[model samples]
Target: VVGAVVSITGVSSTVTSFGTTVRSDLVLQNENHMFLDISLWSDIARNLNGQELAVLGRSGPVMLAVCSLRVTGATKGGYSLTSTPGTRCVLNPVSEMAHLVQS
Candidate 1:
């Protein structure tokens, strides 16, 4: 699917005033109108929109869209993060890692 991230689910809201553990499930589709499923954590809270993500199934490659997002699930107290967020925190935009190969 080439469509954008139409929805996000499974986020815990019962966190402390400070950050807490959580998980986010996403929905993606494309021009062909196929749906893809993805999950991410709160760490990417700031910079994940409009980024390109790819996955392969029995078919060919597909792109995941991430537009508007909704945080779901309930929070109670600090527990070990079920699924770790993409990044607990953001890294330097121009860090030396940019020179490293990715994918």
Candidate 2:
């Protein structure tokens, strides 16, 4: 799903999914405010800020296109993984993804 990263805490990264936009508790933060102690993807053991990413879930149709992520220090509730800086990934809508692929 295509959306923006509203907030990033020690545990979870909140994304606002596009279309119909059903608000899920999975949303740690949004265009508005931040929520603490939310669960996050195990693979996301690092901080992502001002970066866009296409996260492929291990299972289910839950794919997150995240951007504007800010990494905070480790918290007791946060995922237990090392945080390393990396190049940001850009997330585009399906149409945009297809266009880029075709180009």
Which candidate has the highest lDDT of all?
1
For each candidate, the alpha-carbon lDDT, in order, equals 0.33, 0.32
lDDT (Cα, 0-100) at 30 in candidate 2: 31
Each model's TM-score?
Answer: 0.28, 0.23
Candidate 1 lDDT over residue span 1-103, tens digit each: 1233333222323222355534344444433333433454445433343232322322333322322332223336522223222322111212343333232
lDDT tens digits by residue: candidate 2, 1-103: 2223344333233434463322221324333232322233323423432222223321222333322333333446854222223323222234435443232
User: Which candidate wins on TM-score?
Assistant: 1
Compared with the true structure, model 2 gives a TM-score of 0.23
